[model samples]
Target: MKVNIRKWNGVAIWSWDVPKEEVCGICRASFDTTCSSCKFPGDQCPLVLGVCTHRFHTHCIEKWLEVETSKNLCPMCRQWFQEKTDDGDGGTGAHANTNVHSSDVVSTT
Candidate 1:
């Protein structure tokens, strides 16, 4: 028997490494999906992992932190919000301060 192929279509799927049920604390959107403020998912709307072990969309957290009442605190645990960084010791250095303040963010509209 002989077979002849003319054309083929390929598709690929990708998802974040976080658990399927996990969602952004600020927007309550799944890790694989974009937050309410963004139009698309993936790198353009990246996720931020807090020192408190909570994750949120970068835009959501940035907007949240810009509020005077937020006080740069994590929405999930009420702890000071800071980005978790690798300390070169294989352990997370959660104490690194992001120093994000309301004044630091400029309002476009």
Candidate 2:
């Protein structure tokens, strides 16, 4: 599956859709923990990517953020970051971006 990464002139700038696989990032809970939540298999878990690009579930990343305050990096990458603030009241767990840059895209993989 692919969609045009459009340009200003309505031209397709880029096109990509990598096949998602069973990322071992998510902790194999006893059962499906992604219940009452939103996620898929291929799209990386934003949390794991925080430490590294190796994908995992959002919940998994949140847990890491809560536990490891000094470990500000993707579990796979060891990159440090300037953590952002919660965009809004994101429930018990706040939300923030990893500040990852476009140049860092390749390293995450």
List all candidate RMSDs to the true structure.
7.6, 16.1
Q: Pick the lDDT winner.
A: 1
**5 in model 1: Cα distance from truth in Å?**
6.0
TM-score for candidate 1, residues paired by index: 0.75
TM-scores for all candidates?
A: 0.75, 0.34
Candidate 2 to truth, TM: 0.34
**Each model's C-alpha lDDT?**
0.86, 0.44
Judged by whole-model lDDT over C-alpha atoms, candidate 2 comes out at 0.44
- Residue pairs in collision within model 2: 45-56, 50-74, 51-73, 51-74, 51-75, 52-74
lDDT (10s digit) by residue, model 2, range 1-109: 9887766555543212322334434374312224124453323323233312354456665665566663755554556533434456652114454357887778545
Give the residue spans of candidate 1 off by over 4 A: 1-6, 94-109
Q: For residue 29, what is the lDDT in candidate 1? A: 81
Q: C-alpha displacement of 38 in model 2, angstroms?
A: 8.0
Clashing pairs in 1: none
The CA lDDT at 109 in model 1 is 100
Worst 10 residues of 2 by lDDT: 28-37
- Tens-digit per-residue lDDT, 6-100, candidate 1: 99999989888899999988888898989887788998899888778898899999999999999998988899888887767464764466457
Candidate 1 local distance difference test against the native: 0.86
